[model samples]
Target: MDAEYQSFIKTLRAGHKPEFPADAKSIEYARLLDAQDKLSFLRANFNIPTRSPLRKRALDGTVPGAVKQLDISNGTKHVKGDAKEDAPSIYFVGNSLGAQPKCVRQYLNAQLETWASIGVNGHFTSLDNSPLTAWQDMAADCAQQSLDLVGAASASEVIYMNTLTVNLHLMMASFYRPTERRHKIIAEWKPFPSDSYAIASQLQWHGLSPSTSLVEIHPDPETMYISTEHILSVIDEHADSTALLLLPGIQYYTGQLFNIPLITSHARARGITVGWDLAHAVGNAELFLHAWDVDFAVWCTYKYLNAGPGAIAGAFVHERHHHHGHHHHSTPDPEKGVDVVGYLPRLAGWYGADKTTRFNMDKVFRPAEGAHGWQMSNPSVVDLACVRAALAVFGQTDMRALRDKAVVLTGYLEWLLMGLLKDNFGEPAFRIITPGNPLERGSHLSLLLRPGLLDRVSETLAAGGVVVDVRKPDVIRVAPVPMYCRFEDVWGFIEVLKTALEEAR
Candidate 1:
C-alpha cells in the first residue's frame, strides 16, 4: 500500500467524525467510529480520485503522486465540469447509463478523422496502426485485459464484440437447448427488463409460457440482495428440469458480487448451461470466467471499463467448449491442438462466402469457435477505439491491486454510512441493505432510506451538492470508484450527508 493512501485511511478512521442530523435521537457515534476506523485501514491502498479541489491540493501538498487528474466539472446543480473541483456536485448517477472517461473522446476523434480521410482505405492505410491489424493485433491485448478482469485463464477464450444483451441472445441461441424434460430457464426476475424479455421470449419460442417456463429468484421484500444459498437450493430442487442458469455476475441495483464461481461450478456439475450478464462486474471486480467453467458470459465495457457510452462490449466462451466434437474445425491445426484460425468468427458477411469456393456458401450456419463464435455482427471501429484507449490505461496498472483498494474503499464508505446511521437515526429507523462483509459486495453501498424520509433525505443530499444516486422509493447508492474515487471523497461525502440529513429535517 502507498504511504499516502495509508495516511488517508488513518485520517478517515480517526479524524473524521459522523455528524448527527437534528431531530434524530438514540444513536451511538463512538461505536460507529471504531467500525469506520477498521474499514478505512482496509481501503487505504489504492488510487481513488477526489472531486474536491481543496482536498486534492491538501492531499497533493505533501505526497508527489497522491492525486490523479480527471477532467470533471464541479457544479452544485448539475455536477458537471471540465476540471476537478472542491466537493464536486455532479455525482455520477448514470453509471448504469455510462461513466465519462477523459481518454475516450480523444481516441474516438482520432478514429473519426481516419474514417473520414481514408474512407474504406483506412482499413489498410490508417496512420500509426493499420485498420486490418487493429482487431488482429489489438484483440489479444484487449482480450487479455478483459480476461484478467473476468478471471479467465487465457486470452483465447475471450473476444471483444457487440452490445451486452446482443451477445447474451447470441450465446443463448447457441448454448440454450430446450427439451421436453428440461425445458425451463432460471434467472433473476425483472433482470434489466431486456434480459427478462429475451429469456421469456426464448421460452415462448419453444412453446413455453413465461409463467411456467422461467424461474425468477426475487429478493426478500425488505432486503436488496438475494442469497446465494437460496439460489443454489432452487437450482438443486429443479436440477432435473432446469436446462440453463442465467445470472448476472453482479446485481445491478444492490451491487452484490454474486458467488459466481461457486454457483457456476455447481450448475455445471449438474449439466446445466451457465451464462452470466456482467454489466456491473466486468471491470468493477475480479472474475474467473474460464476457471469457473462458466459455459459462456457477456458484458458491456462502458461502465467500470471506462469505455465511453455505447462502446462495444465483449464475451467469453470457455476454450474447452470449442474443441474435440463441438464446432469441428476445417483442416484444424494439429500443432496448437485447436486451430486458432478456425476459432475466428466468420459471421454473416461476404467474406465468409468460401473465398476458395463460392459453392460452400450454400451450407447452413456453423458457429465460430471459442468466444468469437458468439459474435453476430462486426463492431463499430469508433467504439473499439474508445475501449482500446480506456483499456490502455488499465493495462498499465495491476487489477488485483485495484480490486484490493476497491474492497477497502467501499468498505470504508459503508463504515462511514453505518456511523451516520448510528449517530443520527439509531436502530429501527434505517438499516443498510448492502451486505456487511466487503467480500459479498463491490465498490458501491446501498443505503436504504428510512421509511417516510427517503425522498427528503435524497433531495437534501442533492441540493447540498452531495452526489449519491437514489433508487426509486428508498435506496441511496454511493460508489467510491477505486480508480477515480478518493479516500477523502468518502469522508467528505459522509460529512455532507450529515448536513443534508439535517437540512431535510
Candidate 2:
C-alpha cells in the first residue's frame, strides 16, 4: 500500500477528530484537524483547479480590488506569475458542481478506445478484456454502484438514465395519477425551479388549475426552516384531495435536509404517492428509498456524485411498483387508441422494453423489470463512463463513513463561521439559514447576508481564491465535500471570507 493510503487507514483506525480547541481559529489548529482526518487522502484522488482566470491578474501584482482590463489580443490570455501553482483553490461549491475526479479521464479514454476499435460492435462487447458485462448493460452497472448511497434494496430499484428534471417528469407521469377526489399535489413552497415547473405542468396536464390543485408548505417565518410538523400538517389538511406529494430530500436554497422517511411514510399512509427530488441529497445525505417506501425519487450526478456537468442522472422506483401488472400485459384499446387497462401508464420507449424481446422488433411494449423499465432511451456512453469513474471512487468507501466525517467537517465550518462573526464584527454580517442542528442539514451552508451585500461579498470571495455560489438576492451557498475537501481548506475559506466581508463593508 502507498504511504498516504497507509496514513489514511491509520487515521481511520484512530478516529477522525483531533483534540484541537473548538474556538481556535489558527492555521495550526486546522492542520491538527487535517492530520487526524480519515478522508484526507481522498483529496488526492481529485484534480482541484489551482488557479482561476479571475485571479490571474490579481496574482500578477494587480491591485487587490482593481478591475483589470482584459487583453483579448490572442483570445484572452493571462501573464504567468510566481503565484503558487500547486496550491488548490478553497472549493466550497460542491453543492453546485463537484471537483472532477482524476480517474474520469482514464475511464473515458478506455471507452474512446473501444469506440475507435470496435465501432457499433462495442455495444455488445467488452473492450477491456474483463469478465464484466458488455456496454449494453452499462446503465445497470452504474446503478449498482449507487444502490448503497441511496439505501436502495436492489440494483433493479435504481437506474441511471436521464437528467434530474427529465426523470422527474417521467416519474411524475406514472406516479402522479389523479382522480376526481384526489387531485391535489403537495410540494414545498420554494423547491428548485425545475421541480416546481414539472409539478405545475403535470397538474396542468391533468386539466387542473395549479392555484387549487397544487399545495405548498412554507417555512416558519421566524426560523426560516420547514418544521416536520408543518409538512405533516399540510399532508393531513390535503389528505382527502391529495393525489401525490413531491418534495426535495434537501431544500436547495436553505440547505435543509428534510426527514424523508417520516414524510414519505405519512404521505403513503394517506393514500398519496410520494416522490422526492433528491438532487441535493443523493450523495450528501443518507437515504433509504426502499425502507422508507418512497414511491419514486430522482437525482443528478454532477453535484455530489462528481460526474461532469449535465451528466446522466438517476431514478428509483419501489420494487412493489415494478411487478404491479407483470402477469398482465397491455393491449391497445382499439376504440380509444391507447392501452387503458395495464400497469402504470408511462411514456414508453424501446429501451424500456424487456431485454429478451427488446431487439425482437415487436409491436407490443413489454416493460423491463424495476427502475430499468422507466428508461426512455439508451444512456449516453460518455456520460455513463464519467458516472462509472465517479462511482468507482465511491466503491472504495461507503456513504456511512463519509456521512460520519461530514458531520464533523460541516460542524467545524459552522463553528468557525460563528466564531468569525463574534470575533470580527461583534454583530451579524450574515446568518446561516441552514438549520443549526447538524442532523437537520447536510454539508452545504446557506448564508443569508444583510440586504444588498450578497453579490459584493461573493465576488470578493471569488477574487480571493475561494469558490462559493450565490443564489440571487442574498444567499451564498458553500458545501465542503467530504471526499476531497480538508479541514485546512475550511480554515482558509473562513479567513478569506473575513477579508471579503471587510472589503464588502
Candidate 1 per-residue C-alpha lDDT over 239-357 given as tens digits, one digit per residue, 9 for 90 to 100? 88878899987777777778998999888788788999988887777787777888888888877777767778888888777653324345643322234444433234322232233
lDDT of each: 0.64, 0.82
- Per-model TM-score, in order, reads 0.76, 0.88
Error of 1 at 464 (Å): 3.2
Error of 1 at 98 (Å): 5.0
lDDT of 2 by residue, 93-210 (tens): 8899988887787788788888888888878998655423467899999888888899999999999998999999998888777778888999999988888889888888989988
The Cα error of candidate 2 at residue 448, in Å, is 0.6
